[model samples]
Target: DEYLERESFETSYFSTVAAAQEALDKHTAASAARDNQSVTGSSAFSEHWDILIIHMVTSKLDSHTMRDWETERNHIKSIPTLEEFNSFLKNRADLLETMEEAQSQKHTRRHSDISHNRPKTFVLIPTTRINCEALNIPSHIKLADPTFSVPAEVHMLLGADLFWAVLSNNRINLGKNKPTLVETTLGWIVSGSIQVPYSKHNKMQSYNTVHCHFLNNIELEEKLDKFFEFESVSTTQQSRTKGESECEQIFTQTTTRHPDGNFIVTIPLKESPECLGDSSQQALIQFKSLERKFNRNSEFKQKYTDFLEEYQTLGHMSENTNPQDDKTSYIMPHHGILREDKLTTKLRTVFNASSITSSGKSFNDIQYIGPTVQDDLLSILIRFRQHKYVVSSDIEKMYRQIYVKEEQRSLQQIYWRSDPSEPIKLYKLNRVAYGTASAPYLATRCLMQLGQECTDKNVGETILHDFYVDDYISGNDDEQTLIQTCQNSPTEFMGEKC
Candidate 1:
């Protein structure tokens, strides 16, 4: 009810500029009428102020002030009233004034002899994992990051100026198997590695890299050129491995076109899928964990549920109606990935085909990871730069356009439910799943096959050579030819419009 009320207020009053202006006028008139009443003070006006406009006030505040506002607001259990916000600001103003007066009375000092040899930018040290528990440092000391045993990529680096400022003169050594503790304003940072007894299985390897460049060395350039030349596709006809050859042969033998013009391809299995044991239990556990996340975030839950519904609406997935034996069918766990940088798709549902089943073999482990069938990125980019007018576009839902064979669909089953209290439903992916190892190869191979059947020779050649996976990147010197190439070659492949 609260959610609906908030949505109604926002939609009615703030959906357009005219509506917002009318709301402002109404509020202004209400304030004026309230002032004329028998109420005694300014508290009457604040108490009557609309709480929805509080965000507008906070948005204009400085970072520190906004953080303080949030801290105070979080302590309130229910929706904070307008009067409470006004009272918070008043108290914040008084506190700032007191701090300013106290700071004004303090003496200022300057340092003259700080070292100039300090680095302008800090670089990461690719250090081995440091064991914090083995150090066994004093109880009074606090580590900067408590879970240092788990490796983490560094997000922020302190420069030389801040580095020296934070450093303290205190240090402690806790013998051979333990690391030393260095004191800093942030916390005590554990330094160095621990030693263990000699064993073949307990060996640690450390690697160091040093970079050197000779700018005007002719010999170096010639050697580098020769090395790249030897590795080039034009110079070397790379031999195919046994697995890759088998995978290609299977794809050729099993691929078929539906009457509707959709290309259906079998899952390239190196081993039988029967080896995979029942994975429904594992998938159920993962589904319950996903439900816990949904319980905390209603907005995220709505978006995720909407995505699944759309997938089903597009015929990418369908509920399994038949009772298939557990030995032949495989269940896949799924998770959501959130990419804030994306403009359209902020959340993506990805199925985990590599999850280990009860038989210790995953669907991916039994299937052959087909060899790369598309042009490399560097080659595509090089060819892309040669044209006078460049154009690039990628296929929408490229993998989903191609259908997996009906026999192979059992290997891609998933368990899902909108709510935790609801009975779990079984569904099978109808199209090629994105996370499967053979998906990229199968999708690209189909495009190559389409290119082979094109009636226009020039358009046919462009489709063959210009594509990198599903992306068509190419151009011609003439604008008309470039536009014509894009129009004729890229539309209606495998029953899908580009």
Candidate 2:
């Protein structure tokens, strides 16, 4: 009895395993059948698919179908599942098929009525022809295209499906290796090849080939040629102007270094400072306008006052005592500029040297802008990517760090007042003032001059080439090399007093 019970248990286990295997096979077969049915039915529901898959599939749909899909999508108010999309598509297909069937039946009935009512006759029309006199061909032959002899782009070619329909049973073969002329519904066509002929002078005769070019095509080619010229690799040096050369010479001759390692660069003037007229009236007008704005917005007024105070506190500007009313002394009008994106110092005062003075000439009009002295941003970025270790930092108050000549300080004077009730006073900037035409040249030239004095050649070269305006961006393949280079510079070469 115990043996029978054990055998019975063993039989039950084998049956359970067999049944499970069979169930698994059936489940897999059902899944495959459902997928196949969904594909075949066109409108049948499918399993849910990823939203990205749906987007890709929908992009391939025709305009009318996409419109319907959009309407369904709007009704759903969210991204539709693959099953829902399939159901919607199925309904659209059914409606379209029904309409097509109705249209086909209507057309068939109309055609039947016309066939019964109209006369049974056929009309043969002659093909279009052109004068082949320019080609000097036989008068009996007709040319299909008037400009066939002229070199032009072929718009279309007759495919195999239309070959027999256009071709006729007529053809004329001139001779061996000569082209054959075939008659067709499109008129006569020339096919095959011909041999080149020699002139009486024992040289290959030149074929009179005329090329037809449209105006737009000519314009397109001209534009393409210009694009190619701009894109072509060139290694020519940029030519410097006489004014630029003079500006460079002035910077080299006059630029000096202070005891604190700060550079003193003279303003590169294109015209004599005496050319400038009194700008006191313009400065006063601008001050009054700024006062009106300050009175309206308390927050803006506070920021503006703070900026000027900081500028003065940093010794970047000083009160101009015993100010002269002469051509050499021009007062610049300044306004506050707000930069919301800046984390600190969101507001700053911008001195407008371009403001027109009494003589109808601005200070900027008489100043040499000087040549761009720094490497372009593209070059800086490309070189930045070359190193395993990279570092980026910008000088603090770059322009303010450089000192301007004492005589030129009068030229950089500005009108300022803390409040509307207070009298506006003249203050002269002690550094390379921003917004002046020569400011960029002065600041950049000072940096280059400082770089020339560096003890390390590599550090000097990096400062000369890697710096774009105030920012320093450079790297080295070796980490230790980059560390050493950074350590050697920053304090003396860039970041500090220099």
lDDT at residue 254 of model 1 (Cα atoms)? 91
In model 1, how large is the Cα lDDT of residue 181?
Answer: 73
Give the number of the best model, judged by TM-score.
2
lDDT of 2 by residue, 1-498 (tens): 543454345445544544553454344334434554556454333343335445656675665456656756655644566566554554343222221112231122232210011111231111112223422345687755544543344333232335546777887875664556677776776654434446576453333221111123555555655765665322112335789889999999998877876788889888888878879998988889998998888998999988889889988899987885433788889898788899976887788999988788998999998988776675567557656689987777889998998888999998887866777788999998889998888888788876777776776788787789888898877999878877766646554433
Q: Given candidate 1, what's the lDDT at residue 454?
A: 69
| Model 1 lDDT on a 0 to 1 scale | 0.68
> In the order shown, what is each candidate's alpha-carbon RMSD?
31.5, 28.9
Evaluate all candidate structures by whole-model CA lDDT and list the values in order.
0.68, 0.66
| Winning model by lDDT | 1
> Could you tell me the lDDT of residue 498 within candidate 2?
36
Model 2 residue-pair collision total = 0
